[model samples]
Target: METFLGIDYPTLWFLVVGGLFSGYAILDGFDFGAGAWHLFFKKEESRRIALNAVGPVWDGNEVWLVIGGGALFAGFPVMYASMFSAMYIPFILFLLFIILRAVSIEFRSKEEMLWWRKMWDISYSVSSIMLAFLLGVVLGNVLQGIPLGENFEYQGGPLLEFLNPYAIMVGLTTLALFMTHGAIYLLMKTEGRLFAKLTILVKRGIIFFVVIFGITTIYTLIYIPHLSDTFREDPVMFAVPLATFLCIANVPRLAMKHRYKLAFLFSALSMSFMLMLIAIELYPVLLISTIDPQYSITVYNAASSEKSLGIMLNIVAIGAPLVLAYTVFVYSTFKGKVKMDETSY
Candidate 1:
């Protein structure tokens, strides 16, 4: 077992994969959140402003998703194969929505007809909402455990079985969280009446997220006891959740103080913390097998060869910083309120 800073290659790759996805969730999350609020703005000008708020960086943000998916496939091919196969339907739907979203964003303002714009607006919003929800549903199912039979094969009943109550709840919670996150982003990128409207929307979004989050938390505690086991075993692990709560609480507080920049920062932090909690809970095990615990895909069983991981880690060491630098440069270049020029989306 090769080690990197006292952590084995498999565990180190696990952290790498997790970090990539966490970056995806934080970056693309606001895009989905912003798109989800498309139809909420009634006027054409307002809608365009909202659309343009994310227009500059939305595609760049999706780079994280691409990198994250590639990392997963490279780092843990077995777990990737098993999870993708089991959740094939949802992933297909996710792909469909992703295409629809990109199309809507690119083509919505190309035509002068009101009907055409309305059609794309609806497509964009619905696709955005579903995309966010599906991400959560997948996460919930992963947390809940899938039916893996012999040889890490999926033995789940049917496609619709993925839509269990817990998964749906998690999906809705994800949607709410994204909507709130998007609203805060909008606040930073708008002014005057649109800004005032977003302030109200942000408040409502916060309440919506907090309520759904509370219900989801209660349900997880009551129904999925395994998620909390790690915290119970080590009292210090409780600090993560506590910090997550504080970060979440700070979003609204900063928003109320008209400090949307910090609000957005905290929103991104809260998301990072939540994913961290998930990683802590599911360490070692990449995908749990409900059919037989022994068949579960774990870090050790699912990872690629140590040599491959070491080589990739070296590549990532060079590539990741470049990607991060590019991302920072893009955002810094397009910082502040969106101005609708002729080329605007």
Candidate 2:
């Protein structure tokens, strides 16, 4: 446990992994949210506008997920192996939809045929929704923990265990949150009739997310006691959830004021704060064992050697800024409302 600054290598890697995944969630989240509204836009032009809104950065956004996965594998090989093996089914479906989503985005405009476009639109929306849901499901499972035996292996009965009520609730909440985020983005990138329509949709999205988020919070407080243990110990940590609440509340207020950019910023902040809460909750532990606490895989026990983490940290230090710069450039290049044309997605 070599220390860097005031933190150890394993803890630093944990933060790295958490930050990468949080980046993925925030960057890709709005695009997935946009795609979730694909089926709602019946007009070809509206759909195209929606697609083009995210066309420039969707693929690049996914790069975070790849980097996050690689970081996880590199930093915590044991947790990666065990968790992936336990949730193989969900991960496979996630991969399948990831491929389907990319194909849908690419192929939807290749043909002018009505049915062909319709097919891809359905594929894209469905895939995006499923991807968000599955991600939340994985997170929920991680929070709730699994039946881990000796060697930190999953000892659950079947894949069905992954879809319990709590996980499903989390999945739905994730979808709602993303949809709300997407709607706000659409609000920013549209005007006139479309903007008016999105305003109403954004209100509904706000309602949906609020109700579901409230339920998820209550459920977590009541049932998932482990997640709140840290907060319970350090009462000051309550500020995180408070900040998350204020951020979520600010989104609607800002949206009402026609401050869509600020709303989107707050939405992104809410997500980051939520993920920060998760990181705080799971600090040392990567995967909790339902069967026995002794069997849990923690950051310390699951991490690679200090030398390996040190090398990768240097690599990430150099590479992450490049990725951030690229992301900023892409968004800046395509900022403001989307205009449809032959080149449109």
Candidate 3:
């Protein structure tokens, strides 16, 4: 329970892990979003433009996910083991689709055959959509609580239990959110007929997201009331959801005004706020237990030793900035519209 700046090691490590995942969601979100729109661009040039829009930084964005995973294992080994064990099938499918998506991106252009390119195009789009949906499914299950027993082991039934109604709703919501996010990115990178198409898509994306988000919100309030308990107890936490709504609403408004840069920023902000809300709702508790309260994994119970967390903090302090700088540099270097050339993705 060693304290730094009035915060303990476990809480600090929790923030670190949350921040890393938030970084991944905001950075690679648009990448997944872009890929999610792959099939929409039927023309070969349009598809190539869409791919190249994310080419410079798609792989680099995944660095945050890798770091986030490592940090989770290092900081909360028990939570990592138990959560992974419980969601083994979903995570495995996640990994498989990740590889397929990467392969689709890398191999799509290797051969110019129509069938070859079309096949990979479908693969890329399907993989991206599924990845986004699966992420939401995992998040839904976490929010809904897992059936954990002694030693934090899962006490759930069959693996298919992971696909309950709530999880599927969240999955579909996540897909819509990411699709909207991707449309905003494409709007920024495309022009002419493509830009016009994206403009229409962005509008549709907004409606799609709003409808799904509304359903998810109502469902959570009615069925998953516990998540709102924190906000009810602490009035200040209301700001998080309020900000999220504002950001979400601003996306379509800004897009309509043709202010895409700001729209994209708001889209990213909307993502950041959603995650912040999750953190607000789940702080101290990493994984909740449906079996019993005693079986839940809290930051206090699940964290590594104080000394270990302190050491890792030092490493992250040094490494995170470097990673941030690299991200900024890459984006800055590739800023503005994607121009096709001899070496475009």
TM-score of each: 0.99, 0.98, 0.99
Compare the candidates by lDDT and give the number of the best one: 1
In Å, residue 83's CA in model 2 sits off its true spot by 0.7
* Candidate order, lDDT descending: 1, 3, 2
lDDT of 2 by residue, 35-64 (tens): 998898878888888888889889999999
Native-to-model Cα distance after best TM-score fit, residue 248 in candidate 3, in Å: 1.1
The alpha-carbon RMSD values of the candidates against the true structure, listed in the order shown, are 0.7, 0.9, 0.7
Cα lDDT computed for each candidate against the true fold: 0.94, 0.92, 0.93
List, residue by residue over 156-185, the lDDT tens digit for candidate 1: 887699999999999999999999999999
Q: Which stretches of candidate 3 lie over 4 Å from their true place?
A: none
Write down the worst ten-residue block by lDDT for model 3: 25-34
**lDDT tens string, model 3, 261-336?**
9999999999999999998898889999999989999998999999999999999999999999999999999999
